[model samples]
Target: ALLGQQETNLSDGSQQRVTQLLKTAEPGGLYGAAGDLSDALPYRDRPGGLRAIAQVHDRYILAEQPDGLCLIEQHIAHERVLYERLNDRWQLVPLTTPVVLEGLNEKQLEQFERLGLAPEEFGPNRWAIRQAPEPLRDRDDLPDALLELSLGGNLDTAQVAIACRTAIRNGTPLDLATLQTLLDDWQRTRNPRTCPHGRPICLTLSESSLARFFRRSWVVGKSHGI
Candidate 1:
């Protein structure tokens, strides 16, 4: 499904791939570029390589590659980036004004605390956050992450779910600067092909695969969210 009504998330391909290609770096590791692809696509190059040209359907980032064009799913691309980034060992950051979270059961509270959220019982089924992981703290939507975390059964699953919640959603339209920055970060991720949850991040429609192709760039602004 392109849009998930329950969580406002997007899911495609019910079949999850068994093979996982995680970065070689340890947990909490920062990934470097994977270098140029063998197919002569410079999508990973920083100084000069694939260039952001347009956005398609206001969801996919359109970039110009030597072979043809690349369509990167913005949501999954950011999801993968956030997922890998959250994979690193967390650095706790205390909030200026402690945040309160609700809708968590005792078990969920324990699991939330286990993820080192510094959870405290505020009241009946309410938890307060004394400190948060560094990556999560920077986000304006800490509550969103906490809400998503409440559904997690374990640390890893919770982290992945939190990343999905925190990442830029599919309908968001990013400016060229934002798209370029996102692409740079996406290229740096070790597993750019598929997100941790098994959704495709980037799709290349090479010249060989296209009978005809046209690039169309829409206006970049808030009214359109492009």
Candidate 2:
């Protein structure tokens, strides 16, 4: 399948040895069998030259590399994906309840108004979740979450920070189906490059970049060396 390629090549003997090693690397031997067998088997193939393959199983997402195995928090990935989608789709669903915020000083209120949220939308005394965005409907703790945000002075930046925290936390585990859905949604995002807080959502390292990290070309005094 040629998952990836490298400038260096393994000898025929080494390739044969790797094939032999893979024969014994059964479902339980190295990478556990959990997801669809079709997706699982080829990821463990020897001749494919895979650098890594990450998959979500029943209870965990595992990353397999030649050096070692790693268990990743699938839920965090799902949350990031979901949050990105929700943020993009915000205008699609109007606020179900008009949220009245209280406790904001004049400056805070001014900031909120500048951001397009009116005092009426928030309600009297700066308190009340008369309506909330649809994505947050299923989150039972949302009211309390909004209250905390209001208490903190209703600064626009602070409000966004609170929304991010309420969206999702790291370390949640997701099933294969959920992971697939999350990834699919993520691909659809216009700026899948970064999260709402301006943090990078994912990173990519090409073969050339990896070679520089190891100073491979530098050792040979090549033109493109590190």
Candidate 3:
């Protein structure tokens, strides 16, 4: 049975309002919004085989490839890069100003020490960071990073927390140069398809995929299957 509502209608006023809202809304992840990127593509000989073009919603990077356009989630891509580096070995760096964390229970504190993180309890339910993993030491959100360390016991989880804390967040503004540097680093990583949390770092919209969306003759054929 067709149980769901068959259709819904929007009043003229409602439709107008929706249109205005959409116009103001940021383009979240349109990889090929500029369209037909057969020219000005980069990194044709690079390892990842993607040429970054622009950033959308400050969270995803748009790249051009031979097949079509690619959209890369910025935060997750950086996380995967960091995770692979951390898994290889520990690299600790001292913090200029120690970070403090609160609200952790006994088990959580033990977990940090087990992972070789230097945390000293100050007042009740409070701890101060003496040193941090090299990748995370310079992060602005060091306190939040300490909390991430307490998430699990094994080295893998530790890497996850550190990577999450250090990577760039949404709403960040980056120029073309910075985006290129980021793409270069991402390509250097051994695994670029998925993050440590198993989230997709990149997505591709191939030429055939775009053709199908537009109902082009190249894909649908002149006869339309007769």
Considering every candidate listed, which one attains the maximal lDDT?
A: 3
Q: Per-residue lDDT for 96-132 in model 3, tens only? A: 8888787878788788788777678889878887888
Whole-model lDDT, model 1: 0.69
Candidate scoring better on lDDT of 2 and 3: 3
Assess each prediction's global lDDT (C-alpha) against the native: 0.69, 0.45, 0.71
The C-alpha TM-scores of every prediction are 0.66, 0.44, 0.67
Angstrom error at residue 10, model 2: 38
Candidate 1, 125-215: lDDT as tens digits: 7778888767677778887776777666777787687678778988887898899888888888887767888655665666754533332
lDDT of 2 by residue, 25-125 (tens): 32222335531122222223332222224454443345343433333333444445556545555431345655555566776556445534444534455
By summed lDDT, which 10 consecutive residues of candidate 1 come out lowest? Answer: 18-27
What is candidate 2's TM-score against the reference?
0.44
- Return the TM-score for candidate 1, rounded to 2 decimals: 0.66
Q: Is candidate 1 or candidate 2 better by TM-score?
A: 1
Evaluation by lDDT, superior candidate among 1 and 2? 1
**Rank order (by lDDT, best first):** 3, 1, 2
